[model samples]
Target: MSKRLAQRADSRETEIAAVAADALEGRVPAGSLVCGDPDGVVEAALGGPVWNRYAYDGRPAQPWPPEGAFPGAVLRQPRGWGAFAMTLHALAARLPEGAPLWIYGGNDEGVTSIPKRLEGLFGEPETLAIKRRARVLELRRTGAPARGGLEDWREVVSVGDAELVSYPGLFAHGRLDPGTELLLGALPKIYADQSVLDFGCGAGVIAHTVRRRVPEGRLTLLDMDSVALHAARQNVPDAAHVLSDGWSAVPAKRDFDLILSNPPLHRGKEEDFGALEALVRGAKDRLKPRGALIAVVQRSAGVGKLFASVLKNVEALAETPQYQVWRGGV
Candidate 1:
């Protein structure tokens, strides 16, 4: 491993990535494919041009798979089991017989059992490396017939009277979460011609619900995950979509009359409030003069104070034992 990777392996956030980098030390070839490289460690360690695909828009790589064949491929395990399975199936279908495939992840991410899962299609994974509580395994593609794609994971979820098409890996994938349900029930009256923005729209449930109330209104759905954006497109076809991290992809001049969300608070397995904090702090700039930001969150998150710090007329719209709906006006 390079000196930089050696240092990264000791860090909590990039330990798995460093392990992946170390495992591929002398094996990576030019034009290799890499997926789910959240920290770009694998690509940087490869030291060559690579075709990379990332689900989150935060990465500079393509969101969808690129066209072409590769000599080898590396996949950094994702947090969601369904996403991992779907990606594995897709890679199995794409790779040619005998092509090397490397998979790596932290122990906490279920990496230890991956060998059993790889036995059928890849013939059996060879243990490559284990360090820093992370493991890397290598296998050769057997070219076995792969079963499904994104469409196979599609589920039609019913939220109240609205039916939404969702797929695996999205937040609240096959059903509505209680927080969003409460927010929906307590939604304020919206004008027919008002413009609305659904921040962190997972599968378009919130946007779809609001769309029914405002047929003449302009709707924009924003999310960081391409998979969630894909489902949002299908669920609310008429609405505009923006694949962004926080408010990065939103146009500065584009202000909305209302913004709604059940914003994400977790990054992988760790509780993260960065996105939520950014949304609250930046909502004032993104909203029109009379606009308001309405959202539902855990009652214990203490988000009401954060909202009051940056926005005016902040109040709790509704509350349940586990959740609270808050509205902050510009």
Candidate 2:
């Protein structure tokens, strides 16, 4: 496999995607399978059969298991901050007691001690390790039957007071992001009621904020990453959730009153402003006349200048040495 294609689970979304890919390739088997992190599993080896793991986002994901749904079981883990933590929760719930559970990961990702920590919870592990950063561990767990999953989501202290239900692989492990804070603080004045689309709505913070600010507003949260969208569903319960590459699932010529985002600028290292720029251009089509689009990016990105012709007005609400809040108002 090409090194470029064999991605590591650097983040939660990547982790989910990676594991999904691995399941497809055949690296991980279908029996007694519950990957600690889907993304890691996906990118590991290659696509293979996957089963008995849950990927949850509070609201059920479409095309969710059932269709081509593998036999063992796939479910959403209980609410939590880290994918590892959540995955452990999933395993606790799904694994038959006393029927050993195995967790695998890269050493650079700190898997060496995961087994030790796990042994405390599930009993000592049948462990294995090797160079090139890999470890395999199996815990001898008692079949107490999983107690249950977390009933409620937790709120993060930072990141503009954004709310997130914990899930495996999300950054800050159950909290808000600082970059999001800078963006939210500079959000333009949105009306009390409007049709809004939140692209790349990670864990649904912006969507939740919008819904809270405008109780009657129709909100559509779109994200390509299942884990993010799953979190988005929890984060934006009132909003409609769509899984597609940036607006791909959205209908064209359907206008929105407001579109907000702290759009991501990179995809695993190749700086990708393509989606953001596409939004800058196509967003006009999705906006009712004179509607607005708000965004946050590093100052050096110069996105406003790049899309000057597409937008009627582009201004900076907040600017620092490193970042800028640019609003594209029609």
Candidate 3:
């Protein structure tokens, strides 16, 4: 397997494609399952193979795969360890006897424990390929192990008057986020008939609270992570949920009275402000003339400058020890 891996000048996406192509040629049988490919990259890599492309990110609301047994599968390792572990269980439980389940991820993508984790599940995991800072692991399902399923990771938390259900991978899972609490506290008393947009509606915490506060307000929940959206779908069932890449998934012509977000500041272990910056810059276009973008962020993240660059006026509505809820508008 090591000999088959060769260093190549290819983007991460391309490396992922190469891995997929190789799997199709050898281990991964035809009509196998593909998990967490919301972007359809794995399917495209296999040259449009007929397979169950199970994706969760908010973009498309595909039902969870059937709970029957499957011959084999190829899965992209998720960034969060909890999500990754949950995915491994999800794949393993559905695998038939002696079926190979290929899990792939970059080192930086938080899959360093593939060996130990897979060993506990499938006796021993086979290293398939190691190239371009990425590795593919092969685990053949053989026996049942005492592994906690996704249900074990589930929790119900009460915030304000709403009880939100969240899984391990979801942001702030099993706990209330201080920033979101601050943002929710800072929100105006009444929304009435206004339209509300929860930009990064993790577990629909903000959406649920706001809906209770403003029952007449039309709520639209958006998030790039399918896990978050999946939780949001249940937490705020009546709200319009959208799976999008930042502002791309939202319709430009559809203006909103208010935009609320507790935007994530990190991508995996790296500190990334791309999502937050995009939200600030793009909010004006989606907001009505009097509409405002309200967000809770770390005060030291220099979000004021970001808000100033996009909106003519920016106001810090509330501040805590580590967070500030800012409101900006044209």
Candidate 4:
């Protein structure tokens, strides 16, 4: 990894610690709301037994802002601009007038640009602290309740013959991505009764394609993001959905005849191969004896080596200047 990427990978905990320290030092008020806190770090730092929590991903927390009043809110900035904006809007709508909103994030995650987006709904933010290349800012809810409901952000896009419903912050939101289009075009024929799992399925595009090809086949869609999964549920209602981080929430007894994806490569602003690597390594245990795992990735991802390490009969199914499709069978 490059020096910057290495620092990004290593600095998450440190950045969270810095935010937590500020929260503990009286920046965050008691009975505050919180979101994007991995492992509840900020909540723990606040010395609270319980706090109103919201999560966009498949964490053990509320999917929407809780109904009630809060003295303030502490938000760990989300990766995508859409996710962050949605969360901010939701908080603004729910928080009482003058309630403090404490937002913090790494500089690389675009912490400094937050105030610009807050122009209408929040007062000018006060810079609380800047440490460990991370920053914390305090602002008060000012504008009238903004339209922050999930339906408010809904978008629909046409892909081939299908119209997919998606929200912002989702991969390739409102359109089909080139890598996925390549993967779809090059997909192998599916048997009518085969079981297929769309690993890291975003908005169920891959699973939807598989469904049209083999309507009788049992389909499963898995992803960590609740918002994307919500869109997937609308687009492909027949497929079983699993909100999980990797295979953590998937039942071990379940196995698939085929698994496919255009796997995610980035976590926040940094290139993260951990999820992709884990998916490749764990496919062996999740696939049936003759099942295969197929995926599309950037040409430079070096995914072929990982596929070869665990899966037998690995081969490149298709290739382009910018992307490659790989398939590996057990």
Q: lDDT of each structure?
A: 0.79, 0.57, 0.72, 0.79
Q: What lDDT is reached at residue 81 by model 4?
A: 86
Model 3 score (lDDT): 0.72
lDDT of 2 by residue, 133-182 (tens): 34455565554444235332234434355545745455445556666667
Best by TM-score: 4
Candidate 4 lDDT (Cα, whole model)? 0.79
Report the backbone clash tally of model 1.
0
TM-scores for all predictions:
0.90, 0.64, 0.81, 0.91
Model 1 pairs whose backbones collide: none
True lDDT of residue 248, candidate 1: 82
RMSD of 4: 2.8
> Which digits, one per residue and each the tens of the lDDT, describe model 4 over residues 234-268?
98899898888787887665389899988877766
Which stretches of candidate 2 lie above 4 Å from their native place? 1-30, 34-81, 98-102, 123-147, 150-176, 224-237, 265-285, 299-312
Stretches off by above 4 angstroms in model 3 are 1-27, 37-41, 47-63, 66-69, 118-120, 145-154, 159-162
RMSD of 2: 6.6
Go through the candidates in order and give the C-alpha RMSD of each one to the true structure.
4.5, 6.6, 5.9, 2.8
Q: How well is each residue in 81-132 modelled by candidate 1, as lDDT tens digits? A: 7777777776776678898889998788788878767636786888899998
Q: Could you give me the TM-score of model 4 versus the true structure?
A: 0.91
